[model samples]
Target: MRLLQKNKPVIRFLLTFFGSYLILAFLYNLYLNNASSQKYYPEFITHIVALQSQDLIEAFGYETKSIPSDYDPSMRIAVNGDYVVRIVEGCNAISVMVLFLAFILAFKKDWKSTLLYIFAGLVIIYALNILRIALLTIAIYEYPEYTDLLHTTLFPAFIYGVVFILWFIWIRNFRPKTSPKDV
Candidate 1:
């Protein structure tokens, strides 16, 4: 009892951090592992690529085939018969890192005040990822030469930058207050 009282704040902070981290990590990993292992994500990406390529070809009167394939996980653009476009599934690491940071920042010092902040940050991250994937796909198809720029530099920076801004706002405005006794 003495030990618990003496270290109450530290213990509370640690428990909150570990608990939130475990849950967030588990769910994130489970989603990625399940989505990647199953045919749903791959097929969905393939269909989107194929349909978009077909539309572009039809609109532009081009004769190129761009049937989607998992030949390269980074990025790839190909021609089939009457389609041309790029497909990409990169930036998984960037997204995970953003979420992890948000989890850490929102829960490390105080879990209660920042719970909603963390949730909003996570939702923003998820939505941004989908947009990133779509933008990269279109970029690859439109300008294959700029694939490296889109995949390696632009998208990662944009996504992570947004996460950092959100975290900063949370820390500035919503962080828990500590009394002198608590400190």
Candidate 2:
């Protein structure tokens, strides 16, 4: 009891963090599973990514089109029409968003600030993901030999790296502060 009382704040923080994270993760899994039952990929996000990818590719002067894969409607992408790179639900970044949300919530700040930061962060993540997909589509089109390296290494690193930076910023600048006495 003495030990617990001494570390009450830390204990409370951990409980809140892990509890919220698990709940959110479970909810996201439920959403994904439900969507999967209906389609191979979540239509909403994947479709948008496909469309955006196509637009980016076209803007770059590459002939591109986004279409449902012959294998599944849920699977789609902007392709050169020959080397098709399907954008599935996993590529949509919703899971990553959920994780980011969980971390932000765990180290909470003022309600208004928290909400605004979350919104801004989400927007940045989504836009970066779109850019990542666009670049990846071009890379795959131009260098099929580096497909595995691009998809598995470079792009994931970019998104997760950005996410790590965002988390660092949140902790450094946005997380609630404590007085020297409190520490």
Best by lDDT: 2
Per-prediction TM-score to the true structure, in the order listed: 0.56, 0.87
lDDT of each: 0.57, 0.81
RMSD of 2: 2.4
Instruction: Write the residue-wise lDDT of candidate 2 on 54-164 in tens digits.
Output: 788788888887666667655555455675588887788877888888788878889999999999999999999988988998898789899999999999999999899
Models, CA RMSD each: 6.1, 2.4
- Candidate 1 residue lDDT tens string, 1-183: 988997897787677666766776787656655555233334344445444534564455444444435564322334333223344443443336545564455344566555556666666776666566556555666787997887789987887787778767765776666788876
Residue pairs clashing in model 1 are 64-83, 65-79, 65-80, 65-81, 66-80
